[model samples]
Structures are given as structure tokens and as C-alpha cells.
Target: MKSSVNQFSTQFEWILNVINVGVHIVNKDGDTVFYNKMMAHIDGLDREQVLGENIFQLYPSLTDESSTLHVALEKGIETIESIQTYVNLKEKKITSINSTYPLYEDGEIIGAVEIAKDITKVMSMYDQIVDLRSQLAETHKKNKFFEGTATYHFSDLIGSSPAFQEAISLAKKAARTHSPVMIYGPTGTGKELIAQSIHNVSAQRNQPFIAQNCAAVPKELMEGLLFGTTKGAFTGAMDRLGIFEQANGGTLFLDELNSLDLGLQAKLLRVLQEGEVRRVGGSKEQKINVKIIAAMNISPDEALERGIIRSDLFFRLNVVTIQMPSLLERKMDIPEIVNHFIQKFNKSFFSDVRGISQKAMQRLLQYSWPGNIRELGHAIELAFNVMDTGEVMIEEHHLPAYLFPSGKYSVSNAQSHHPPLKDKIDLPVVLEEMEREMIINMFEKYNGNISKTAEALNIKRQGLQYKLTKYGIEKVYAAGSKEPK
Candidate 1:
């Protein structure tokens, strides 16, 4: 019986080592009892050195408070799908999603086992997809214009709200200088439109106006794209001019700048500071004069907190800053924006949809546009596609199905409980009430933790606090505070 048990244990160990997923086992004393080949590879460690070692001693960076395996072993608890980031003993930054559970023998916890899936590659792929989409959009937009002309100008910006006007004013001022400009706003808030307008009005308007979204390309591709590649750089590599060389004596608009890796960002900062770029696999550096206009869909402060943008890079790029307000903050401009889109689609689709009805407009205003102006444009386009040929006015029924999922609202039903417009219902006040209620609800849902509440609402912590103060509401807890027990 003893000989059979020993053979079974050996076979089990071998099977664990052969599995694809990383597996790590530690005894109750936190001594490594089993460390599979897969786990060793994932951790960048040798299997022989890790086996029968003290896990804490091997990984000095990990502690009882920081390690899931230690926690599970000491507490006999299970942790599922928890994301963990750490610097390995090799000093490599590693990110993985892990599941750890206590190992039990005869109703007593004897050890802990961790199953891990490294997500570094997965995250890199996701970043590439994000950058690719942005690049594709810019390419499409550029194709619509004449070879070197910018499609958007200051006059083409279609909003009358003070918030938007202020952003445009700042952009116009930024265009006059040779300094780098940083534009920050929520997604779909027309950051690209503003950037293009600045380029068209700038000193380098006649020169090449190249645009690249930092997140739109993989790191390897991005390096080559920004700084030219040499013939011997890699297999099938030909001498190529990067964006910096292409846009010399012109403007290079880098959208989603926060998506750039920190290391790449540092290189970009050096280029900006030194006014030069060196091609990959090339020895000599070439002088270039490229005006960089970087844009981000997230607030600069939030990006800083998330480590998406390097502090030194941001300071260098933020010589001029433009903050575009979201559609919600500038709701008064929706009517004009909608009208503009209607005319645009009419010309594009050959449909003469005159305008949107007041009822439909009201429904649009009521919606919290998570996608901002872009979503509004899409909704209008969708309505036009489904409208009848002779339909002169867009009504509630013409709107997208998702906008009114419950059912279409009749004009009478919409106005049933509302006072007559002759009484002059304050539109701003009503909107403010709705906004305040949303903030309060999210605040409570997050247990008054300002950071979590702000994240849930997709706004900056400063913005949330401003709203809270505007509404005369007090937070139950401070930012980053834990929930009440």
C-alpha cells in the first residue's frame, strides 16, 4: 500500500508540472511544497530553485498582506479572479488574474494553491485594438478631405454653449504658438474636431498635418511609426520615414496620448525637448520641427492618478491646454448640434428630413448621453434611416429603439404631468436636479467613497465634488475611504 501511494504522488506531481496554467502550492508554514514548471516560467524563475523553498523568502516583495497564497493559507479562505500586479524577483513587472484557495486534508487546512493566468499579453492586445480603431477613424476622416487640407475649422464647430465657446477660444489661442498643446475631454466630446481646427488655423496649416492615435498601434509598430525604421532593423525592413520626419515643419496630432507606454512617452518627451528623432536601428539623429498636439479622452488629473501619463511628459505637453465640456454640461447646444447633423445627413443620404420635433428633442435631452455628441449624431442618423420618404419632421418613433426601450411616448403622455411651457419651466434647473439626483444615488451606492463614486459616474473626483457642492450635498465619507461595516 505504501509503495502504491508513493507512485501515485509522483504521477500527480508530474501531471501538475505538465499543465499549461501556472500552479503554485505552499504549505501551512508558507514553505513552497510544489512549484510547477508552468508557474516557474510565468514567474521567470527556475523550477529547481523554487521547489521546497520558503515563498516569502524567495519573493521578498510579497508579504502576508500582499500575497493571495499567504492570505489563503493563513486564513483558510478562497480568492477568485483577483487581479494582482507585482515586480518579480527578476525585477520584471508582472500582472496576472489569479484564483487561490486553501488546501484541506481531513477537514483541516494544510496548504494553499494558486491558479494564475497571465494577462499582460491580453492587455497589450486590448491596447493595440484601441489604438487601431482611433487610427482607422483618423484615416477615414483624412480620406474625406483633399490630400493635405484639414476638414474641420473653427467655424465648423457646431455649438453655441459658453462651455464649448470657451474651449474654442483657448484652442484658437493655442494655434498661434509653437508650443505643444494638450486637449482633454470625455470620449465623443469632439476632441479631434478641436484638434483639427487648431491645426487648420496654425502657422503650419499648409504643411503636412499628420495625425496618429498613440493607442491605435502596438508598441512595436508605434515605435517604428513615430521614429522611422531602417532596412536592417528587422526582417523585410526597408528604410521608412516616421511621423516625426513626415510632419517636420508641420503639426503632428497624437490623439489618446495617455495610451502610450511610459517608456515610449519618455522617448517622445526627449524628442520634443531636443527637437530631434533617431530612426530605429540607425546611428544618426535627424533634426525635425514638429508641433505636437496631444489629446486624451480622460481628464489629465485622472490620467495622472491612473499612471496613464507621465508627469514630465504631461508638463511638457501641457504648455497650452483645452478642456472640452461634455454634451451633458452643454445641453443647450443639443438643438443646434442636432440640426447640423440633420443637414449633414440630408446631404449625405439624400433625405430631406426637415428637423426633429420638440417631443423627440425633449426625449433626447432627457437621455444621459454616455457617448456625448457622437452618440447624438448616431441617434439622428439612425432616425433618418428609418424615417418614411415624405417624413419631414423626425418624431419620437423615429428615434433609435434603445433610446425608448419601454415604448414610444405619445406627445400627450410626455406633456401630461408637466406644467405649460407658458409658465417657463427652467430647463437648466430641471437638468441640474436630475444631475444632482444621479450624483447622490451613485455616492450612496459607493458608500460615500468619492473615488469609487466618481469612477462609477465616469467623471473626475474634482468634478464630482464640484457637483456635490453645487447641490449642497455632503459626503458621508472622504475620497478612498472604506465602506462602513
Candidate 2:
């Protein structure tokens, strides 16, 4: 039995030294019996220097009334998660949250052990953020030209379909009032874009406008970030305004609103109903004049059915709800969207790629586009990367290989490669572009080996040679060059 106790004690000591938490133990006589390395560093003293020193000698500021360890020792009272601030032996100010307990041996008091987490640096960082937020808030109040952060306006929403237009009309009406607006749609359908557009067009456009993606932020930190924090709210928290206060008199856009837990949703509902907010761990409620715009990736009914969104909160935010159209539902607008992206990338890439070929454009129209508008933008951007310099059009092969699921419908499968064309799409030009990019990609793949490139194209060597020569691709990118002739 004694051997087992000795073994456990040895393991405990090893663990005390291994962990970052400060550990200090003293005998009943008030002499330091064990002081681990972490405790030494935290107290700014060497282990050799504090090993046998009396507790009072090491921390002269500590007393029977003030020190948690002293209370645990003399009074047999354990203190858990108590905040302690004191100067160390080096005269450096330290802040810690400690749990101190009295040690017992056979129902008799033997000693005291204290575990402390150093929070000095954390407190310092929190104070810095609080100061910065205070400055930002003051700036917003004094500066009229400081328009909020929303960059997209109503003009930026680019789609001509009726479903898209209906969503836009509802969103424009939301901007006229400060009522809470909720926008729901499938993922990447531009709920955030609509939210930003509303803020940009509203009366409070000159005030602060900020967004918080509930899905991106961790659940534990969301409350403090949304509702603000009071000093000493937790071990290291400092008084700071949250997203609600930061965007006072402007807009607070909460994207993926369903990602917040039910408890947070209830708190959000109260703020919407009352026009007031209370900081975390704070007793006082302050009035804030801010517009709230909430976005959800899924439908409100679906979110409510899954218990992901509270019914009361949904009712409050539903005062002006807008449902954005999925790209598939507005597929007729693909040409305009594609052309807009083409013009956008032309300026950004500093390239003059004229437009997408008919066959490639048709393929895009046929795609299901699970990612919606975001996916469409990404597809165009990808085509730009592979499109040959000086080429006037984005060809079918230049689009991402992922777009053609399992590569089954790629240019190599030429018999089934062509998208069914409308009246205006010139079949000869579309076929020529597709054939050229296919041979070019194959040449790059096989390092311009005639036999392999022809075999991969499922054609005879002579035929492949004639086609490459016919298209003038035989010399320009024969080996590894991606440059167009």
C-alpha cells in the first residue's frame, strides 16, 4: 500500500511539472514543500530559489486574508476559479485564476495545493482590443464621410430572371426601414450580397456596417462577439463593444443565422424586440440604434424543423424576409452573368479574352451548379487561368475538369462532347475550338508524343497529325508550352 501511494505521488509530481498550469504546494507549517517549474516561471523566481522558502517570504503581498493558498491552509476552505492579481518576486504584476484546495491525510489537515492559470498576457491583449474598438466607435460618431463597410450596392446584383428580380424587389424595400430583415437561400446564392446591398442603399449608409458569419465563428465566442463584454466578465475579458454596438445606427449583418445555438437565438430575439443590448456578464442594458439583417443558408421552415433555429426568433426577423433564387432556378440569366464575369476578370487579369465559346457556354448552362452564383463565378475564374493568352474565347476544355463529373464528357469523348446548340450558335466554330483545345491539352499531357497523343484522342496517328496541322497547334505548344501561336 505504501509503494502504491509513493508511485502515485511520483506520477502527480511529473504531471505538475509537465502541464503549463502553475502548481504550488506547502506543508501545514507554511513552508514550501513542492514548487513546480511552471509556478517558478509564473512567479518570476527560480525553482531552486523558492523550493524551501516560506510562502510569505516568496510572496510578501499575500496574507491570511488575501491569499487563496493561505485561506485553504489555515481555514481549511477551498477556493475554486478565484481571480488573483499580485506582484511577483521580480516586482512584475501578474494576473491568474486559481483553484486552491486543502490537502488531507487520514481526516487531518496536512497541506495545501494551488493550481493557477496565468492570464496576464491574455488580459493585456483584451485591453488592447477594447481600446481599439472604443476608438472606432468614436470615429464613426464624429466622421460623416466614414460610410460603413458594405461595398455592394443594388446595381451589383446581376441577373435578369423573374425569380431573381422578385428577391431583389423585396430586398430594396427592406432598406427603406430599420426593421430586422431575414434573407434565406441555398448556399452561395448571394444572401450576403443582398444584405450588403441593403445596407449600402439605406438611410444609415454613412454609419458603421459590419458582418459576422455565424458559421465561421466558433460557438463559444459568438455571444461575447455579438453582445459585447464587460470587464472581468471571465478570467481575462475586458470591457468591449460587440458587433451590435460597433454597428450602432448602421447595419449588423449576421450571415448563416441558423448556425447560432437556440440560447443565443433567444437572446437575439430579445434584442430585436427591445432595441437594447446587455454585455456578457454585465448588469446594465444599453440602447443601440442598429439595423439587423440576418441570412440563413437553408429555408426557415427547414431550419425550424431541424431545431436549428428558434421559432420565436424566426417570427421576429421575418418582418421583411427575402428568399434568394438558386442559380439553377435562374439558369436563363447565365449568359449575362458569364459576360459580366468575363468583363470583370478582363480588368483584373489584364487579359483581353473576348468570351466563352458556344459549346463551353452551353455546358455551363447544363450544369446543376450546386454552389449557385459562387460556383458560377469560380467556373469563369478557372477558365481564365487555363485559357491561352491572346485567345478570344474560353473553350470547353479550359473550364475546370471538376465541372465535368468523372471526366466522362470531356473533349476526348468527342462523339458526346457537343452541347445541343440553339439557332445562333455556329456549329462549325464551336467544333473547331473544342477540337483545337483537346489536341492542345493532349499534347501537353503526352509531352507532344504523336503516338500517345493520337491514342489518347482515340484516333490514328496520321489523322491526329492532320488535325493538329489543320488547327496550327503542331508548332506553338508542341512540347510543354501553354502559349497560343
Candidate 3:
């Protein structure tokens, strides 16, 4: 039995040493019992020298509170995917993602085993991406003539609806101060436009204005982008200025701020609180004078509920919150928005499209634009592209096919005049007939494919079949076939 146990111990040590990840095992007293070569390589230490030493003594920088292995052993707890950063005995800064779990023998805790994966290279690559983006932003700033400094001022924010005007009123008040502003609105509701207007009217109007979409950047790269990086911080990391430093004495507009990782959000909260940022690899923090304007497609409350935005960060950014109304909320502005797009496309396309017809405008108003102003703008652009050179008006025919997929209002023919009613019309019967007609049209359009027809009509196939039977259109469906039935 003793010989067999000795062989098992030897095999276990061999397996631990050959594994890819770094492994360090410590007894209940926190003395290193097993330290693998991978752990030695990761920490730039000698495996032979590390064995039998007190973990705290080998890496004097780590304490009982900070070291995962020590904490697990002391508390009999497990730590998973905890990011740990510490300077090694050689004074080399090492960053790793660690998972530490307590070991048990005979129902009693004996020691702790820690598994670590060095993420220094991954962080280095993220720093490089941040450096490149900062360089591009700097280049864009220098050539302001080409990029054109945000031309949309407060005057250009075109909406007179009460909800929109109330938002603008709050924004104008916010622009007068250096306090951080948080703007919340649905996508395509011009959140960035409001950010630009705020910057253009702020005390830092002439200073650099930098806008970055948080969602556009990879989550891993965001921290280094917001906070500069320093040399020797990680492998291949170099000294570089982040967006915060670049936009010093100016406004740094972070669009879709909720998309930023919560861990990075804590770092951002620190910057907002201290008005300073330290580079990724550097030891010293630098002061910054930046006006932050954060925009989110989701409401701050919703983001908080989803745990996407940190509560502390949200409270800090909520100093001046402005909720921009969606296009649906301000349908009164659609006509003016449509006209603006028409003029915009006329200049770009060099076409002389005059205006949209009343019927087309009615169609625009009747439809619920889920994409808000951006979708409306796209619809106008699509219409302009299809209009002929001699065509002066943007008629319903010029609109995109997706806008009226049911072909309910095809502009191929003029509006049919209905004869005067002699008595009270059976409204429900008329509506039922219209619904049945629409279902039949969809069925025909999808070539009797029940699945496709049901999907197009936004109904289940079984429900569509019931409707077909109720309308006596069951003949359209073939038995036991995928078609209509």
C-alpha cells in the first residue's frame, strides 16, 4: 500500500507539472508544497527554489488578503476568474486571471490549489489597439478641415415637440457647466447629435471634441483606450496617451456607455471622481480636465436593472440626465425630418426632388417607426434614389418595398373613391373582410407556403390555417403538405 501511494503521488505531481496552466498548491499553513514549472515560468521564478517556502515569503508583495491561495486556505472558499495584479520578486508586474479552490482530505480542509492563466499578452494587444485608435483620433483632430469640427450646434437640433424641447432645455443648462452629462434615448433618436450639440455650446467648444462608441470597441480594449498605457506594463506595451488624455480640456463623448463592461465602468467612475487616470502599465496617475458626455441607447434605470451599468457610475454620470424622446414620441416632427432628409439627399445625389406627396406623408405617419429618426432618414434616402430625373415629388412608389410589404398601399394606381354610405356601416364585418383579404394576399405572395405566409403575416401556421378555414379559403391549402395547410 505504501509503494502504491508513492507511485500515485509521483504521477499526480507529473500531471500537474505538465499541464498548460500555472498551478501552485499550498498547505493550510500557506507553505508552498507543490509549485509547477509553469507557475515558475509565469512568475519568472525558479520552481526548485519556490518549493517548501512560505508563499508570502517567496512573493513578499502578496498578503493574506490579496493572495488568492492564501485567502482560499484561510477561509476555505473558492475564487473563480478573479483578475489579480502583482509585482513579482524581480519587480516585474504580472497580471493573471486566477481560480483558487480549497483542498480537502478526510472531510477536513488541508490546503489550497490555485490555477492561473497569464493574460499579460492579451492586455498588451488591447493596449496596442488603444494606441492605434488614439493616434487615428489625433490625426483626425489635426486635420479638422477634412473631418469638419462638429457643425451641428444647438440651433441645428430640429424638433419643437414638448418632450424634445424639454430635453433640449435640460441639455442647454448642462452645457454651461463642466459636470458630467448622461443622455439616454432609443437608438436613432440622435443621442450622438445631442452630444455634439452639447460640446459645440460648452465652455470647451474650441478645444478637442472626441466621440467614441463603446459598443464599436471590443470590451477587452476599452480600459486601455480610456486610460493610457505605459511601457513594461505588459509584453510589447508602450507609453501611449488614451482618449481621456487626448480630449483634455475638451469633451469626451462616450456613446452607448452601457455597453462598456462593468469592471471597466468602475475604472471610469474613478476617473470621473478623481479627474485623473493612470496608464495601464505605469505607476503614476496623471490629472485630466475633460468634460464627459455619456450616451446610452437604453435608459439608465433599465441598464442598472440589467446590471450592465454600475450603480455607482450611473449615479456619478446622472448629474445632468437628459432623456431624448424617440421619433415615435414626437411624431409631430416627422414632416420636418422628412424635408430635411430630402434636401440632404438632393445635395448628395444632385437630384432635384422637390417634396414628398401627402399620401406618402400619411403612410409615413401611419407606420410605427421602430428605428426612429434614422429609419425615417433611410426611408427618405431610398425614395430619392428611385425617383427619376424628371420626377419632382417623392411619391409612395419611390418608397422601399419593406415599408409596405403587404402591398396595401401600392402607388401603382390612384386612390379609389368609395361611394357614399346610405346607412350605418358594419365596421367589424368590413374589418374582418380586410383581414381575410390580407391573409389571402400573403398566402398567394408566399406561393401557398404556410410557414412563410404565417411568418410574413406575423402569425403562427396553425392560427393561419384556422383563419383560412373561417374565411372558407381552406381549398388554398393542400392536405398533409407544407403548402398553406
User: Best candidate, lDDT-wise?
Assistant: 2
For model 3, name the residue pairs that clash.
none
- Span of 10 residues, lowest total lDDT, candidate 1: 416-425
Tens digit per residue, CA lDDT, model 1, 1-485: 99999999999999998877799998888888888898888889997888788877777667677688888987888988665666666776665768899999998989999998776665456445435543543554466443444678999998889999999999999999999999998777888888888888898876667788886565655776788777756422357678788777778899989889888999998999999899977898999998899999778998999898999999999999999998889999999999999999889867778888888998899876656887688677666665656678887766654455353445553433232231223355445545755776677667787788888999878678667644544433233544322
Evaluated at residue 197, the lDDT of candidate 1 is 88
- The C-alpha stretches of model 3 lying farther than 4 A from their native spots are 1-148, 405-485
Q: Per-prediction TM-score, please?
A: 0.58, 0.64, 0.60
3 Cα displacement, candidate 2 (Å): 14
Q: Write the residue-wise lDDT of candidate 2 on 324-399 in tens digits.
A: 9888899999999999999998888787988888888888988777567776786677666655556678877767
- Give lDDT tens digits, candidate 3, residues 347-443: 9877788898997898888866656787687677666555555678877766644456565544352332221221333355445555765876676
RMSD of each: 13.3, 15.0, 15.0
Q: Rank the candidates by lDDT, best first.
A: 2, 3, 1
Give the higher-TM-score candidate: 1 or 2.
2
Specify the highest-TM-score model's number. 2
Residue pairs with backbone atoms closer than 3 Å in model 2 (clashes): none
